[model samples]
Target: MMGALGQSFINGITIGSSYALVAVGFTLIFGVLRVVYLSHAAVLAACAYIGYGVIEVTNSAVAAIVVATLAGAVLGVVIERIAIRPVRGQNHLIPMVTSISVAIIIEETLRLTVLSGQPISYPDTFASTVIRLHVGGAEPYFTVGQVLIFALTLALVLTLRVVVQRTWVGRAMRAVADSEDVSSLLGVRVNVTSARTMALASMLAGAAGVLLALSIGAIDAHFAEPLQFKALAIVLFAGLGSIPGAVVGGYLLGFVEAFAAGYLDTSYRDLFAYVLMIAILMMRPQGLFGRRLTQRV
Candidate 1:
């Protein structure tokens, strides 16, 4: 039983790390822009397809990931400049509605383009099974990829902390998050900062897309929907604008879903995500790391 639990814990971390990456991206965008960016998932899925094409041509996973990241970054820049910029300073709902429309368009384009009712597979390089750490004295070993996922997650968390706390760009981003008006007054180039934030968020999404495609070994348009909701849940639960919160929230949600599948009904795994979201909202509306809202009467 102890061994079983250990293995399960490892599995949870592996899945949770991916969740954390997605959540981080969501939170980054929210921090600087205050936009929900519902289309981020479409960007992820579209990049994965682009990665798939790269793999097909070069027969290399690394090459494919590079191409995908560049494609995703460019897409993010275009979307922010074209689709999102027009609605800037309008009611928040206007941008959100625009994002939803863009998401639909992206999905439809994906369905009609590279992902026409078929699953795209990456090269065999991603198919090799790596050995994960041993647990339970002798049984049920996890794979290397799972271990990599957890390690990569830790690395990402550390990188984010260092970036935010140490870099000039990080300070500008924080300044914007704290108060865009003040940031602009300080000559921080608010527009540039916002654009960079969007690009950075999309880059993270691109990396997550690569890992996700590798883990699943397949890519399709429909697969993006669940990840989209999952990422949103993580960001919401982690508290808007809090990077560490996003990490913690992602891991928590991932573990809950995994354990639910193990102990409760397998079908209840996803249902539990929403249940937890609702419970958190009812009990603590601000979320785990979210700040309390203040309003003037």
Candidate 2:
């Protein structure tokens, strides 16, 4: 029982780390633009396919990841320029509706053309090897892919923290998030900041999509939908714009999923996630780290 528990814990952490990556992207766009980017999942799926193509040509996972990241970043900028920018400052629902339309177009395009509405096997990489670790009386085993996911997630989160808190672009992003008009008055390039925010968010989503596909060994156009929803829940759980909260909420949700699947049924894993989200909202509507809202009469 202990062994099984330990294994589930490890698996949960791995899965949750991926969730964190996606959630962070969601948080970034929301913080900067205040628009719910419904197209992010489509972006993730599109990038995964792009990664697959890169692997087919170069046969290098590293190359695939690099190309996919760049593609996602470019796509992010394009989406912002074409779809989002036009709707900016409109009713909040306008951008959201636009994003949904864009997501549908992208998904259908992939399904009809490249993906053909079928799942594609990810290129085999570190997934082929399993590393066993012995600690005291507990021997837990993990795949190279899982280890890579965890390590990369840690590094990415740390780097994101530094970028958001210390860098000039990060400062610009925060300023824009606070007040776009004020930031522009203060000489911050609002357009450039928005573009960079989208790029960074999309890159993170792209990396998560590729790594997650590699971990699972297969991906389809629909694969990112559930992940997108989970990312939303995680972002809310972590606090809307709090990067660290996103990370922690991601791992917490992961553990919930892993333990639930391990001890119960896999079908209930998503249910558990929703239930947890509801419970958290009921207990703390502002999220674990979010600030309470105030309005002047």
State TM-scores per candidate: 0.90, 0.95
Looking at candidate 1, what is the lDDT of residue 87?
81
lDDT of 1 by residue, 66-93 (tens): 7777787787887788767788767889
lDDT of 2 by residue, 46-132 (tens): 999998888888777777777888898999998898878888888899999998898899999999897478889987765547788
- Clash counts for the predictions, in order: 1, 0
Lowest summed-lDDT stretch of 10 residues in model 1? Answer: 126-135
Q: List the residue pairs that clash in candidate 2.
A: none
Error of 2 at 236 (Å): 1.6
Give the top-scoring candidate (TM-score): 2
179 Cα displacement, candidate 1 (Å): 2.8
Per-model CA lDDT versus the true structure: 0.78, 0.88
* Regions of model 2 farther than 4 Å from truth: 133-140
lDDT of 1: 0.78
